[model samples]
Target: MLIGEVARHSGVSPRMLRHYDALGLVRPTGRTVGGYREYSAEDVRRIFHVESLRSLGLSLKQIGRALENPSFTPSALVGDLIRWTEDRLARERELLGRLRAIDASAPAGWQDVLRIVELMQGLNSASPARRLQTVLARPEGVSVPVGLLADAVLAESDPNVAGALRWALARSGGDGVAALAAGVHAEDVDIRRRAVLALAGMSEVPGVAAALADALGDPDPTVRGRAALALGRRGVTAAVPALVGMVVEGSSDVDAAEVLGTLSQDPGCAVRITTALVDELAAPAADSATRIRLTQALVELPVTSVLEVLRQLAHDDDPAVALVASAWVGVLDERSAEDRGDEDS
Candidate 1:
């Protein structure tokens, strides 16, 4: 076959075939009387082989080594190609995410597009301070897409950056609630915790309460505690059990106790919260420390609501428990006395 026939059959262009020949990739075996290049069957087969290697992303130099170097093993080269392809795919995925974020922002012009791009880059900066500064420095009236903020807050590991990202998300009202809700169910324990924390600050948002409610059952105690505390403050009685658990477990007991005390302001929820605390205090497994923490938590409740429980606990088996409970009872009685005195005067 001549060069043109070889090109027609192999789908390799004539110029490329000539280039291959020049590179000693597939030199034709003979030439006609007019001195045109002619290819033997063997030469045509080598052309197909070169094309096959190119399809596998082999550079011409690599192909040359593959075809001509008897000592060359394909394992290392193939591994390199795999890694290179993987890197390219990762870059493409990142670019796609950026483009989606920009489109979601609904940029009005090239400037808006550029600004969103810059903001996204800052949010994803390697330095935690840079990410935090990016979130804090966002100018007023420049609305970042809430989804972008949700993604950043969910993935953020740095404490400061995560806090700033949550603040940014809260400023968007309920917009990021769905994304954060999805993060609440994420398999990554850290992500679920972050999502709950972010949602905790957005309790006023429409869907936030429900998401936090769902997070109350999260496997991570931190997630459950944050969710329970947020809901407790929102007057949701559903958080009663978890809040009592937090107090019993001595995890964030102070904040949990404070929120529970606030929740007890609702007459109906007050009964349930008090009962849950009393139940935990009465549990057979309640150690002295657990009883003490539960006793302390009772101080947040309305004195009238928990006075009976406190009276019973004041003489409890554990000296530490009795001491703490008696102290709180005295404080409550003194306040009650003061209220009555003021009324009379």
Candidate 2:
């Protein structure tokens, strides 16, 4: 085959084939009468081999070594090629993700596209400060993509940065709730915690509320407690049992008590929460510490029944419980006296 014919048959451009020959990766083995390059069958076969190696992402230099070095085993070269291909694939995947985020944002101009890209890069930066600034510094009218924020929120390890990202997601509204919900179901406890944290900070979207409600029963106690706390603050009475448990258990019991007080503003919730607390108080396993916490929780409830419960608790066998409950009784007495004074006036 002549040069042009070989180029035509092998789909190698004539100029590239010449370059390949100049590099000695592939060379025609014969010359025609006109001194035009001519390829023997062996040379054509070598060209095919070179093209095949090139297709596997081998640099031309590497291909030359592979073809010429009899001692060069393919195992090492193949391993290197795998690593290179994986790196290229990773870069391509990252670029594709960035493009998708930009597309999702529906940027109207190149400047908008570039701004979104910069925000994404900053969020993914190695520096926690950069990530936090990326979220906190987003200019007005330049909306950060929620998917990118979702990814960052799930993966962020730095506490300050994570808090900032959660804040940004909350301001983004319900856009990332589904993504955060998926994180709630992640096998990683940390990721589940982060997801719950982000969901808790988010505005009250129905889906986010539902996700939080489901999380109230998470196998992880931390997850359960956090979810219950968030739901309770939002007045979801489903968290009543867990919130009461937190109070009796003395874990975030202060906040738990406050939320319970808010929940008790409704008469029905008051009865349910009071019943739950009373049940904990009367448990045979209730210890002195548990009894004290339970006693303290009653002070947060303004229901008239609180006085009777405290009066009954004020006589408990545990001196600590008696002391705390008796103190609360006096506190309640002062309020009743003040009310009478107001009424008399």
Candidate 3:
């Protein structure tokens, strides 16, 4: 095939193909007298393999080395990559540790100052924005001192770094460490929201779980909804009863269907929770699309109770819900047959 044909088939641009050719990454199989490159099926396969390796975080140079060496073991290469990732994570943890120590100092009103320092450190990397994002992902309370330092870094860092820091902090689940939880219960809605999310990430922390459970009653539905998601994501079985209530009580402004769908995937969640989800699907006011989504989520659950619930939805008044439920029932029927066959053999 010609370059355009290869580009169309592979979803890689012709310019990138030429670059790869120049780097001896995926050379054309032949050339015309006039010099146009021609790629064979084998060459296309090689290009696909190169793309796959790149997706696995291999550098072009590293991939070239692996491809050139017939004896190269993919398992060894993956092990080496894992080691590299581990080392990088260790270094980031160390840097975060230093930032936390800085934040713990007795400096008066040093929140902004500490964040500025952390942001400055983040910008020193090749992808400053991405590095700053990594710093912000540190779980709350687990790294309270780190969160404070990130706050301090954000306060005085370069405007670009500060922006990245803010985005990261927004996603940070400030739950685990005591230092992070200090101001979490503040009267401010935004503060409570951020704190609740951070705490949610700290599900193992007793106080974090308490905070999320309490936030379920917040006047702001958005906060309550997010808290519901946080609890579900944490797989807090303790919160399943409350989440079931949220689904039925209808106080939650957030998509109760979606939250219930999430809870269905929790291995520790009870059959009663899933039963509540099925009941919601039966509601006349429920959107047909949401009902379909709930049915699909139920199908993914391993609990046998899901089979009965799906059967009930398979006859739902909404055609979409019935269709989705019917499809899942067929899949389950097929899986059950296979399991029986395996046992017999």
Poorest lDDT segment (10 consecutive residues) of candidate 1: 163-172
Candidate 1 segments exceeding 4 Å error: 1-88, 139-141, 340-345
State residue 187's C-alpha deviation in candidate 3, in Å: 4.4
TM-score of 3: 0.46
lDDT of 2 by residue, 1-345 (tens): 899999999999999999998998888898889999999999999999999998999999999998999998999989988998999999999899889899989999999898888888898899998888888887887888888889889999999999888888888878899899999999999999999989988867769889998888788878888999999988899999889988877888988999999999998888887888888999999988888888899889974858889998889888999999999999899998999899999
Give a tens-digit lDDT track for model 3, residues 1-345. Answer: 999999999999999999999999999999978899999999999999999999988999999999999998889889989999899998998678666556554335566456555544654556656665656564454333345533333233345654544444444444224543543455766656555545555546556666677777777665676677777766655555556545455545145545555666655454667766667677777777656655665665663668888887788788888888888899998898898899999
**Deviation in Å, model 3, residue 267 alpha carbon:** 8.9
lDDT values of the candidates? 0.90, 0.89, 0.66
- How would the candidate models be sorted by lDDT, starting from the highest? 1, 2, 3
Please name the candidate that would achieve the greatest TM-score relative to the true structure: 1
Q: By the lDDT metric, which is better: model 1 or model 2?
A: 1
lDDT of 3 at 334: 89
